[model samples]
Target: MSVTSSDPRIAGARAAPKRGIRFSWSDPLFRAIIWQIVIVGIVVGIGWYLVHNTMQNLAARRIATGFDFLDRVAGIPIGESMIAYDSSVHTYGRALVIGVLNTLQVSVVGIILATIIGTLVGIGRLSSNWLLARLTAFYVEVIRDIPLLLQLLFWYTMLQGLPPPRQAWSIGDTAFLSNRGIKLPLLEWQTAYGFALLGLAAGIAATIWWSRRASRVQEQTGVRPSVWPVAIGGMVVLPLAIWALFGAPLVLDIPALRGFNFQGGGTISPEFSALLIGLVTYTAGFIAEIVRSGIQAVPNGQWEAARALGLRHGVILRQIILPQALRVIIPPMTSQYLNLTKNSSLAVAIGFQDIVSIANTTLNQTGQAIEVIAIIMAVYLTISLSISLFMNWYNARIALVER
Candidate 1:
């Protein structure tokens, strides 16, 4: 060996690789960072040019901009709104809020229904019964093949072809289905009921916590606590107790036949009905596939192992396989949920006044296309982000931890 430097400073300097970034193209990290900065700068420059050009053009046309228009009278008629909307009274802002509510209403209900139906069908597809499996498979294949917009049109057409309000289908005058929509007695909501609903929500959270705690107890002591009693108490008893504490106000706003349409109760407009039906069915097909794949991803050895422990098929699925399969199921299910929410924008096609539909109307009425489109994008972004965050948290919660 050649004489080596024993001085600490000299030895350290000799051993250490070169410090600071080299400007040479041969340095991969330096090259990557430089190219990235250059690309970013170019994109920023282009964006600035486009925005500046558009502003100049708008100014030349003397077209007023910004959201000052939201406070002005909307004067836009909205057929179906969750909240009160008077075209002569409300502003564009209120109209947009109504559109968001309608979109959220359908999206929330559709997600719940789709998840339930999808999970059931997915499990059915894996059943030992040949007919059941084949039927589920047929549904998945057919639905996945058809375009969602076409399906929406089909459902809307079917609903539109129903009898008019005057000759509508009815059940003892309490409920009616017609070309107008589904008319049902609205449950008169009370403050007490709202409190009870809050209690129910709290109970659900408690139930989840208790289940996790039970799992930990089982893992540590080889004895799982009975969870059903706690589940029933928290979910059912707690809500009922809260309701009772508030005197349990129960009132129904019954619908009455008046003129061409029903009054005094809720009406699920044909557009709303068709949109909800189409979304639930279409989304269920995709969710079914996701669930099936998640279940299949679990190894067959898991089933045999559970059986060896003298467990029933249903118990094995619920207690063992599914908990593991969730690691696979949750990620894709999140994408489906996001898709359903975004696709709800297609509500405009059939006249359901979702955000996109109302936004388009607002665009025409206000002649502020930029502001209107921005509002639409912002609403979708907020909703999609909320869904993603919740799903990501759940995925993390269920992820396998190395011991």
Candidate 2:
């Protein structure tokens, strides 16, 4: 019954370390690398095959490829521009640039107006007043439900139905509003206006600095500095001061009824007006919904707490609600802005001469459908990417991070 120093049977039965196939084929890292290699090989093989086929096809069809088409005559006239352009003298590149600028002009103004209108409607929709809420809801539903193209057509048709310039509606002898479009006084500027512009720029910089200082002071002293002064000073007082000191430095030119049409004033043109209005109205509906959702995402407790701390409704919304809600609102709002920009291409239907319209003409003239389409895609892609990157950066700035 005495046990030996070690149990002999147990020692004898003990297994040796198995050494065969130390690195198994099923290792995760190995499998991942193998899978990646296979995927890449497939992609490269397909790409090469397609590319070869394309080259052969192009050769067979006798279609030359290069960027040389850009240097050729565009032979297309642009409606509005910062430079002189004619069908005879301008290159395709110049034509494209004009188109791009027109697109930007509409998009920028549309985004600003849409944001203002959308925010107001969104706030109205959340109002305690039943009438206001219902009105806002109706606007959002009607606009968002309709197709944008149809809306554009409606506006255009209404505009074209207006009486001729001789019978155009006049506003107090200084402005004109008509189905044709709005006409306003144009300013003729002088040298002193340049200095005034400079002064205005300086004033804006000062106002921004003051705003940051006020924010800092509030953080330390718990006393919210009045923003009204900075806002008014930057927006109104400074600009007025510059104008007064320089004797306004500009002459107002009002339109006069001359012959068949009004002359000597700036015109919005029926086509441009319709396109801009349609774009703003259509995009604003979606923007309003985004704003409402963003505002709703903030907890009701925040509002109650702000009121408990003696903040007025405006102050509470501005300080506590909007700052938080904007973090949610901005990302989607950026998308609407992008959509509006791309949608401006619909201007072609109304003869607004946007990039797509000009590009279409160039394509038809040169018979380079492939190259023209590529250019259009590249332009839109560039615009979309730039907007997306900016929104992501802004979103990151306000995005909440958890430890």
Candidate 3:
């Protein structure tokens, strides 16, 4: 008989080798953490270097750094101001506030005018009439190609080239236009006007609430109620009634020619007029293209389907097309608005005295270059972020809800 030996030591020697503590190059989590840490370290190092360099430079130059300069007297005259500002009496902060208001004024008005004109041009670009479509395309091409700064300069020159105050252009006795500026009838305000405004606001809220209720009712009853008549009645008629009841606390102060200029009413300065015109015309071109593309993004079948349902052209456009096209149009339109606001900074070149222009003056006066620039940057950043947030919220509200 052959002797066969199976020993425990032989089995232990045949076992697989044990793995010790080692680095794992293929672990996704570990690699990601390592890369993040490396990037953060580099960024921190760079930031530290910049801060140190800036502090050293400041110290060497003996440049005082702080926002205390804002409280100093601003002995600078502003061309246009929404709030009361005296060059000798107001602080630098107050002057800057006026500038901010002016910027907002131009931006808001420009955006409104641009959207209206752009939407019209966009629709015209797709018109059935060949002439209208060709004309719209020409406008888009010409306006978008020219530089906005050049456009502003040209407009300013044209305005300045107009007749002097003695030979001012008049649209009746209520308004005047000249190289100096445009003068218009202003409404004199009163205490009752505030109440009337409140009433009008309430009417608007009620109209919105009614519209929502109407929509829900229609959904449940398969009948769409006409809300426009009620909306108009509330928005217009109610406000007018309230105004009349409050003794009509509004008086028109018509512009009149005085010694050397038109006075006694509101004035739109040449600088403001030029800046507004340039901003509106330039921004409208891009907005027109955006609107056209948004409308075209809708399938042709949508139009055919609406027609098959016997819907009128206006009804189809308002009820069917725009609601859908707005989804595509809003995002790009928001960008154009932001660009318009930033471009308003170019006002300094033409002496419009916007926030940026005024801040530049402050920097030169106090030699607080860093502080002034930082303030300007912060203001612009805040405005841009606010617009972005609003537009994003609006976009979400109108976006499709797919099941």
Highest TM-score against the true fold, candidate: 3
Clashing residue pairs for model 2: none
Clashes of each: 0, 0, 0
* Window of ten residues with lowest summed lDDT in model 2: 13-22
- Model 2 lDDT per residue over 1-403, tens place: 3435377754432321232222445544455567899999999999999889977988799987667988987777777664678879889989988888888888889989999999988888998999999999999999999999999999999998887776778888878876657789998877777767787787788878888999999999999788778877876787778778877666889988788667788888888889999999999899999999999999999999999999999998888898899988998899998999999999999989888998898888777777888899998999888989988988887775410
Candidate 1: Cα lDDT at 48 = 100
**Which residue segments of model 2 deviate by more than 4 Å?**
1-31, 178-180, 209-248, 257-260, 400-403
lDDT of 3 by residue, 68-140 (tens): 9899999988878988988999999998888888888899999999999999999999999999999999999
- What residue pairs are clashing in model 1? none
Which of the two candidates, 2 or 3, achieves a greater TM-score against the reference?
Answer: 3
CA shift at 396, candidate 3, in angstroms? Answer: 1.5
lDDT of 1 by residue, 212-297 (tens): 99999999999999888888988899999999998888899988879867888888889988999999999999999999999999
Tell me how candidate 1 scores on lDDT: 0.91
| Backbone steric clashes in candidate 2, count | 0
